[model samples]
Target: MNYFIFGGSGFIGTHLINYLKENKAGSKIYNLDIIENTHNGKSIFINCDVKSEINLNIPVSENDIIFNFAAIHVTPGHPDYDYFETNIKGAENITAFAEKFNVKKILFTSSIAPYGASEEMKMETTTPMPNTPYGISKLVAEKTHMIWQAKKNQQRQLTILRPGVVFGKGENGNFTRLYWSIKRHRFFYPGRKDTIKASIYVKELVRFMVFRIENKNIDIEIFNCTYEPAFTIEEISNSMMEITGMQRKIYKIPAGILKIAAGIIGAFGGKSIGIHPDRVKKLMISTNVSGKKMKTSGYNFHYTFDQALDDWFKDNNKEYLS
Candidate 1:
């Protein structure tokens, strides 16, 4: 029942680690993060980079379950190459280690970004066309899993999970940004209120992982880690507004005008204005994910976006908003 988690202190991993601790599943838990995640000290912590050619620090046992959750998680500010090294090479290192160490199962957390499907409801059979470096790295890592897992020297079952935006207590990205924007009464609803933004609450992801560990009857395969019915962007936004008691002037800000503004700001180096052009690119598109396979794989849905926000969004808005 041993478990090893990479990037255990991050937004997604933090919640998962906490879930493991609360369960106290009678197994040793280990986390390998470069910065040393002592924020919560339940697990054995080792500060080491997954990109290192050799991971000689931690010991892996035959019954150990490894969850590869480490990654750069790209944003507008990152150098493109950094994403490949951190995401792809990192996964390779873990997969290689699992292969050599005779680990039983390796569950890798990839991103739905690799598929990069538009408004269409993407399925497991969708042809992935990754547009960004982060997306490419994840897809490349996923494409190579079958080879490593099938090696004659290994007894590992590789389970790859591609999840959408995961938010909960340590989230400092898009969710927080949007929450604060709405909290400040600066919320905007582009007239197209129907555009859904696919996402999963953090605890839902943890529940999925733990369930997989407990049920080893199924064959190892990739599953999309997300809620069954995706939440619309406006639905989520309105929830935030209602909970925070804030109201802002809502404007449609014409899509074409916003695109032009984004282009101008990007062309002139939006970094000075604290906006990375790539981040701007992220806002203009919609990413809706499907969890049919994951659902069929035995994970039941847990948190709706609003219900999830209510649990995590307490007074922390002060620190993040300021």
Candidate 2:
């Protein structure tokens, strides 16, 4: 099958490319993104910006898959307007491009942000109350894809995956920062250790996406994509220590002190320290998202959180220590 990926240079996209090559999943893969080439010469790269109007230049055919992973998703990184401009506009253009070629399937990697910051377990059917510009933009992007699918009627298939925090090799996100802190013996919990962090391994996430693609059914479908048994920060830290063989004194600082520190650091523009007040606040909240749809679909997960971390450490521990 011919595959086209938008934002194919980003973390998850890079992993997907590697997965396809390792599994020999596609005959021809076209990677579309604004970033310069990051793939291993396995994909044909087209330096196209999804926010801009341009031809994707991909030879379209029936049963072709268009995977949209493009978005300005880093919280507190870009301005609010940029999120809507890139995410919403990117979805708009991708759907239009798919329509132009009559692409058979379009798989979208959305986020759990649409449900907003939650302390309770969130389901796929939860009423989205997006509280941030990023969340609002992602929710709108999902709607845009649905609109395109509606136009296709029974002729096209769509899979919208709202994934939780995706982490693995080469992923520089919250989870990675945690690893760094543990490695340096500076790991600490601001208050409690039971804050649920919903997450999925990048490889496992791509595998699930590919599974859905190969078993495509003609319908507009959506699924919450994350590993089962939502893990707490304590659980993750314990796993990290076990895998990396690193022991650090886990400090339990008062939440109030950390909150004040976060505010002062954020006011001074200290995101470099990974201590924005907003982010610190979010860390206290549990994003216990449920992926029951994926589980009930009869597809067993390849890696639990522990297994995923083991694979990541096996591949990256040498570089991680340096």
Number of clashes in every candidate structure?
Answer: 0, 0
The segments of candidate 2 whose C-alpha lies over 4 angstroms from its true place after superposition are 267-269, 317-322
Worst 10 residues of 1 by lDDT: 313-322
Q: Write the per-residue lDDT of candidate 1 for residues 1-322, one digit (tens) a residue.
A: 6788888867767777778888966877887788776745688887768898646655668788888888988565689999989887887888787777877787888888888747778877788988878789889888666667767423457778888877777676777777765665544554366666777777888888778766664345777777777777777777766655666655556656655666787678855543444554566567777887877875656766666766665635624321
Query: Top model by lDDT, which number?
Result: 2
Query: What is the C-alpha lDDT profile of model 2 across 192-266, one tens digit per residue?
Result: 889998888888899999999787488888888877777889998998778777777788888888889879877
lDDT of each: 0.73, 0.86
Error of 2 at 118 (Å): 1.8
The per-prediction CA RMSD against the true structure, in angstroms, equals 2.8, 1.6
Q: Give lDDT for model 2.
A: 0.86
Which regions of candidate 1 fall more than 4 Å away from where they truly are?
A: 152-155, 262-274, 315-322
Cα-lDDT of candidate 1 = 0.73
